[model samples]
Target: MNAEAAIDLLKQVVLFALYVTSPFIVLMLLIGLLTSLAQSVTSIQEQTLTFGPKILGLALLLIVLAPWLLRALTEFASSCITRMAIVAG
Candidate 1:
């Protein structure tokens, strides 16, 4: 592939990565914010307190989103593979 095509593929890869990861990232951020707020309000400053909730939240989100995530990932992978074949041949 030419440099332009390669760059476009790279851009797509980056965007896909961001799109797939956004939900998990946003969930973690929200959980962290809530945990911080609660800790501040109650004066309970435990560093490890956030880990449990974050892990649990992520686990729950992963479970709920697994099918959709898998389908999206599979589609992206298939498209990428097809593009690779086209570029190669």
Candidate 2:
């Protein structure tokens, strides 16, 4: 592929990555913030206080979103493969 096409593909890859990971990232951020707030209120400054909730939240979200995530991934992969075939031939 030409430089332009390659760059476009790279952009798409980055955007897709961000889209895919956004939910988890957002959840983690909110969980961290809430944990920090709780710790501050309780005057319990434990460094590891945030891990359990974040992990559990992430795991639950992953379970709930697994099917949709898989579908999105499958669609993206198939689209990329199709584009490759078109570019190649």
Candidate 3:
């Protein structure tokens, strides 16, 4: 209801989003790093070489994490909805 409480809720929302997306982001980052390293070592200049593996990895990651992501988001949504009344007044 108050500005402080609203700010706290915003903080929680931001943190929850970051937490939910962290795994996927980290996965992509590592993939890209390895791709860069291999490209450097092999002296390969093909730009598209990394795309396939990254795409496949991202797809697999999404498939693996989808359920967990959904559950976390659902829980966050449920909690926010349940707190709506308190926040409203």
Best of the candidates, lDDT: 1
Better of 2 and 3 by lDDT: 2
**Candidate 1 clash pair list:** none
TM per model?
Answer: 0.95, 0.92, 0.91
Model 3 per-residue lDDT tens digits across residues 38-80: 9999999799988998899999999998998899889999998
What is the alpha-carbon lDDT for the whole of candidate 1? 0.93
Residue 27: error of model 2 in Å?
Answer: 0.3
Q: Please give the TM-score that candidate 1 achieves against the real structure.
A: 0.95
Query: How well does model 2 score by local distance difference test?
Result: 0.89
RMSDs, each prediction? 1.0, 1.2, 1.1
Instruction: Give the TM-score (vs. native) of candidate 2.
Output: 0.92
TM-score of 3: 0.91
Which order, best to worst by lDDT? 1, 2, 3
lDDT of 1 by residue, 1-89 (tens): 56666777789999999999999999999999999999999999999999999999999999999999999999999988877765665
